[model samples]
Structure formats: C-alpha cells, structure tokens
Target: MPVIGVLPYFKDIHIEEEDSVALAQRVVFPRPGAFNIAVLALPHLSNFTDFSWIERMGSLHVYYTDDPAQLAGAQLIILPGSKNTIDDLLYIRGRSLDRVVVDAARAGIPVVGICGGYQMMGLTVADPYGVEGAVRTVDGLGILPVHTVLEKEKTTVVRRFRFGATDGPACAGYEIHMGRTEAVGGERPLNYVGEGFDGYRAGAGCWGTYMHGILDNRAVVEELLAAAGAPGLEIKWFDYKKFREEQYDRLADHIRSHVNMEGIYRNLRLQKR
Candidate 1:
C-alpha cells in the first residue's frame, strides 16, 4: 500500500487524487519557482525516501523516468541505489541510459550516485563471489574513474562524513551495499568519512558516493544545486519532523470527519464515548 491511497487532496493541480496524497505525505507539494530535476527510474531503485529532504524547499521539480531523452534538460541528475547493481546496470545499458548519463556529465549537469549507483558509474564491477548473481563482471558507465568489486559481506552502517570540500561541514548518512570500490585514477573523492573518504568527484557537477542519505545533508544539496550553476536557487531548510507531525494531525482531522468512527468502534467491540 502507498501513502496516497487515503489522502484526499493535493497541491499539484495535475496529479490525480491518489498519487498526490502519496507525494503530499512525503514532500512539500508545488514549491515556488521549482527547478526541474530528474532521478533515474531504475527497475531496482531503492532508498529514495531521503530525496524528500532535497525537495523540502519545494524549489526542485523532481521526477523519476527511465527515458534517456528526459535527461537532456534536467538541472540535476541523480542515480539512486539499487538492490541488484549488475542487473540494473545492464538495464541502463540495454535502454541506452548509460550514454545519456555520460553525455549529461560531459554537459556539466550534476550527477550524484548512491550505493549501487556509485558502482555502476565506475569503470567495471567484478562480482567474483556472485554476490549479485550469475553475472561475473560488467563494464560501468565509465564516467567516474573507479572500479568496484562485489563481495560476500554486505556493509550496513551509519556514517558521518564531509562532502564537496574536505574542510567544509560534517554530514551524516548511511552505507548499505555489498561491494568495495577504489579510485584508479586522478579522480578526487567527494567526501571524507572517519579516517577514509567516499566516492569520486569527476568534476564540479559530477560525482558518486555510497552514502545512502547524502541528500539529507543541507550543505550537500546546496552544493549540488550550486555546482549545477544555479546559485540563486536558495534553500530554506525546515523541520521535517515537525512537518510530519502537523500532517498527521491534518490526516486525523480528515479521517474523523469523513469516516464513521463510531460504527468502526462498535464493530471492534470498543466503547464509543
């Protein structure tokens, strides 16, 4: 079941009733002066919830699509995590989205990858242990100068790191993947986490990292947009926890008015006082 199934209204005039509710619960709908952004709609995409933080300002018009043509004009491009890296990477190749991503990078459009996405952006992914399946190896998008090898031990841990510049700000995210990657060339890492760093920054607008909730960090989001050459798109971060609580109260009000609560209570053998 999805969150929109029960909600009644939506801020977007275009979205149908059901989907609007789902998005409404997750993000602030119809932000003013929204900048267009695209997220690769992979078949196995996962952990996209953190994107809500990026869209919190309502300044980004975010949409998920698998079409390569859609990548042309996006202000920012994100390659989200996947449960199966090789399979999804093959899917990108089969659909020719790999070329689209590479082209977008050449055009200076910001591209950020998380977890499985980071692996696919590398030079090659070697699955010696068959951690992802029968596929032994696959060539990556060849965008970032890195190589990844799938391992048997899955890494799932909370991480704290510095993004964009090494001396910038300390940001926290998580790592949940089944591979190890190493930089093979002059590509500089995107962040410094603990004693080590994460991801590789190919350019001002090009990078990839294993951090799952990288966008949850305010500095990272601002940097991503600014690197995309839109410095005027100011971010206004708000309390998500507070917003969620308010939404819950609104939902409760709607349910109380619309539902036959007394009837439901009686049916459940509870006192309806």
Candidate 2:
C-alpha cells in the first residue's frame, strides 16, 4: 500500500460531504513510491513555487544538494532557472558539481534544465555586455552542442507550442531568458519559434529548454516522465480556466495557513513589474 500525505483544506473551500472530503484529502495527500526529483539550488533562484504541480501528482522530494552523489538516487534531476547563469555555472564548478551533472547524464538519468539551467547544458555561455557583470564565456556541461550568447534582446512572453508526436495536450508556457542559443553543426533542435532553435533534447535522457513554467503543461510533464522510463502515467485534461482557479485557491489556502498574505502579495506584485 502506498502512503499518501493529506494536506489541510483551503479556507475558501469546504469539504462538507463525506465522499468529497475523502477525495480532497486524497488529493492533498500523496502515496509513497512517488517519483523523486532533485532540483539544483543556485543563488538568486526563482519559480520554486511552480513545481507544486508535481507535488499534486505524487511524493516529490526537493534536494538542494550540490553533491553529485546525492543526485544519484533521484529519478529526475531538474536544473531550475536562475537570475544569473554565469554565476550559477561558476558556483557549480566551484562546488565541483559539474562533473556530477555530466556523470548523471552519462549514466542515463533524465536531466532537465530550464532557462539558466538550459543555458548551462550547452557548449559555451557568453556574457559580453556585463549585464550580469560576469562578461566571460564558460564551458558548459557539453550534454548538447549548443552555445548561448547573452544579448540585449530579452524574450519574455507567454505562448503555446506543439512538439513531440504523442497525442498529449499542447504545451503552453512563458519564455523568460536573457540569452539566445544557437545549435552547433550536427545537433538537433527540440523546439522552434518560426524555424528558430528554441531548445534541444539530447539523446533519450537529457532535455533543455528556455521555457519556464513548462511543467504546468501536464502533457509535457508526462512526456518527460515517460522519457525517464516511468510506467503507468497518463495525461488528463480539464478546463484550463477552472483548473487555474482551483490551483490558485489551493495555493492561497496553503500559504495563508503558514505565512502572512501581505508578503506574498507584495512579492507577486513586484514580480509583475
């Protein structure tokens, strides 16, 4: 029997009926043997909250370890977006975690990098403008033969994309990055924006993309999990508007229980600006 953790209900929603209460409790809680994911901890990291979708699915553990050996047990390794790509890469190298990441990829583990993490998967990352104040090019993990150049043009927008042959739902997300990537000769692209390279998936186990919030796309999550060799997982669709409402309610309730809403609202407002 799998063990699930049932979280308390949000203040706005009430579970008065017996069956509804049980289902809500089950959803709030999760069973054991759930997929474990390791998210690399880099300074100035954001969007940790977006991973709530994964928590809703099953037992998800977050690891902040820079130790390579600690990453070996996770079924999925996520290199999350960071505010400073060059600094994060330097930090990883300082901690000697670069070899760990490469070793994980070589061992056939499913490693996904988003934004700064995505930039780190290439052959070189150049920052010439000193926008990040690093102004130096560094060698990437070399999982993909891609090079990213930090440019004045920053791409920030929400859009929908279709990729992969599976009949799953379309992927919708926001792209927020200061770097532009180009595929080297002989490398395949993962996504395109009107025929421009947006991302790349290397072999069966490694994937990198500039898209943030892609995890919100249930189909994309399922596809990545399947590539990781997960069994018996399927994508299901619901009214997107309704789903967003429910999710906001759930998050509001959860945060309200533990912290003051003033700080949360303030931070969100600043992010929008």
Candidate 3:
C-alpha cells in the first residue's frame, strides 16, 4: 500500500505535440456509426487495441462485450488477442460465449480471431511444455481446421505478408505468442509470411491469424469488410504506418515545447564555472 504513495503521478494530464495537427486521445467521442462490431471481452484480453484502426474509419462501431444477446446484431464478431490463452479459453466457456461463437460461425456471421484468439478458433490447443501454465489440451471453437501447441519459446517478430498469393502487396504485422498453429486440413491459408503460411480461412467470413496490425492496411481491411458482407460500405483509405510515424514526431515536438533545453544547458555551464 505504501508503494502507491511513493510512485510517480497516476492521474490525467494533457498530451500534446508539434503544431497540434497531431490529435490527442479524448475519452469522449461523438460516435456516428453504421456498422456494429462485437469484440469478445476475454478476461485476459491483451491486444484489444488491434482493432483501434477501424474506429478511425468512419461508420464502424466496435465495442467489447461478453453477453450472447449483445453479439446477436453484430455484423462482425472478433476474438482479440489474449495473454493467457488457456485461462481466457476457460473464461469464454464459463460464460458460455463459446457456444455463441460456434453458433455465429454456423449461421455464417463473419468471425475473426487474432493471436491467442486464432489459436482458439481451431480444434485443439495443447500445452505439452506447460508454457501456458498447464500441460493439458482443450477443445477449441472448431471454426477452422487447425491445431495449436504452446511451446516454451515464444514467437515474437514483425512480418510482412500478403493474402491469397505471394505477389500481392505486402502488409505489416507483428506476432507475439507462445503457440504454433498448424493446419489440420480443409482450411485455406489466409496469408503468406515469406513462402510459408500464417493464417487460415475455412470459408466466407471465417478466418484466424496470429498476426497483429494486419488490419492497418487498407486493402486487407477492405477484404475483411467484404468478407463480413459489407460490400456496400466503402472504405476511406489512409496510410496507418505513416500516421503512426507522425504521432512519434508530434510527441517529440510536445517534449521540446515543454522542456527548456537551452536554459538547462546555461545553468549547467554556470555551475561548472
């Protein structure tokens, strides 16, 4: 309890930067949406920000919930990345959201999963090495024909990949997970990382992948929207990578604006004299 008193500031403050063209994150927003997306709120959800880019694209409303009734009207249902796959999987089952996901898949609703969520889209996930806390296996949602095994060494790397063919325009993403998922059969790969596969697609609107940030690419987002049967909804394109870099530049500018570097240097020089 004493540690809290000794630590740094833990409250709200303004964050600004260069010329203010770079926007600050505001808690309140005027949400005018046309698409309803339900992201499963797993107990240990890690990369929920993976879908933040979509919120920038106008007309999409993404919210997280665990209730089955709340998922009923969603055009797209996403299972975001989790830190503890086994624990979160058990959490999903305990809430009976597993049945909801399975039923949604059968009903042909667009269902997507990333990283730990991707592993849960398969038939089985075995933690033989106890990398996920227990040396056991659990049944998955059965949406895709894949099997996952959690090994000791975790996979953490950035990847450039393309959907369908190797010659397509490459999109950027990063993988950070302990499981290695393999195709059991029937499911077509969603993308190619180098000459190898990275994700699986069983049918229309059903796919799973270990890659994060894949949605940042306009082409990939378009395909995903189309798969979700939103062809009428047109996507406004922007380079998310470029946008991210601008954010960093603005952050630097913000720091410079607040800190008097020249004054500090003069004070240090006088002290030495």
Top candidate when judged by TM-score against the true structure: 3
How does each model score on TM-score?
Answer: 0.77, 0.72, 0.82
Worst 10-residue lDDT window for candidate 2 reads 15-24
C-alpha-based local distance difference test score of model 1:
0.78
Runs of candidate 2 exceeding 4 Å displacement: 1-34, 59-62, 165-169, 192-197, 233-243, 247-273
Q: Give the Cα-based TM-score of candidate 2 against the true structure.
A: 0.72
In model 3, residue pairs whose N, Cα or C atoms come closer than 3 Å (at least 3 residues apart or on different chains), thus clashing, are none
Ranking of candidates on TM-score, top first: 3, 1, 2
Model 2 over residues 175-236: C-alpha lDDT tens digits? 87798888888656555544344578785458888877677776677676777787465434
Which prediction has the highest lDDT against the true structure? Answer: 1
Which lDDT values do the candidates have, in the order given? 0.78, 0.70, 0.76
lDDT by residue for model 1 (214-269), tens: 88777787778788888887567886556656776766777776666776667578
* CA RMSD of each candidate after superposition: 6.6, 10.7, 6.8
Model 3 over residues 122-210: C-alpha lDDT tens digits?
Answer: 88999987777854899888888889989889889998898656776688889988988888755478888886888898765889998
lDDT-best of 1 and 2: 1
Clash counts for all predictions = 1, 3, 0
